[model samples]
Target: MGDHEVLASTGVSELSAPGRCSQGFGVPDLNAWFRVSVWSDQGGMEAIARIRESLTLSGEG
Candidate 1:
């Protein structure tokens, strides 16, 4: 399957909020990965930067 198709098949199986942190699950790129993270405005900005860096480094932005 294509990348978009692979991504589209993923779904959040569960969600949990613990204090200031939140986490969820899904198959990431057909790898069955569980994604988790803490919630914060500053963290969002940092994640943006990291994503940009990844795209630029991979020449996929």
Candidate 2:
């Protein structure tokens, strides 16, 4: 929310097995949330972290 008004939003819940999580963000006049689920039978948490690092978000409004 840099340079923009901050709106209210709920926080992300705890992540369990199967590499899944819910992420949320809020900005002036808007709010959004998303769920990320990464599946891999190997590499464990490191794999999830690596995959997550590659995720990106882009928008214009």
Candidate 3:
């Protein structure tokens, strides 16, 4: 079996409310995710593209 390395990062940002705020409607915002892979050699640097998407409390994709 081979061992797998995993790395994770997170961040939060504040956004302005939409045109109008309803009784229960919340403000609009965004979340981002980035994945990267590092090597032990000096050959070169390699990185994966950044992934950004909307987020919810339920953790649904």
> How well does candidate 2 match the true structure in TM-score terms?
0.35
Which residue pairs come into collision in candidate 3? Answer: none
Model 3 TM: 0.20
Which is superior by TM-score, 1 or 3?
A: 1
What tens digits encode model 2's per-residue C-alpha lDDT throughout 1-61?
A: 1233433234233457534433333443445544443344454445545545565545554
lDDT of each: 0.35, 0.43, 0.26
- After superposition, which runs of candidate 2 have C-alpha atoms over 4 Å from their true positions? 1-41
**Residue-by-residue lDDT tens digits, candidate 1, 1-61:** 2331112222222245323333334344444534444445435434533533443111122
Model 1 residue 54 CA deviation (Å) reads: 8.8
- Kindly list the per-residue Cα lDDT of model 3 for residues 1-61, writing each as its tens digit: 3322232343212134222211111222224333333332321121211211222223223
RMSD of each: 7.5, 6.5, 16.8
Please tell me which model should have the higher lDDT, number 1 or number 3: 1
Best by lDDT: 2
Model 1 local distance difference test score: 0.35
Model 1 residue 57 CA deviation in Å: 15
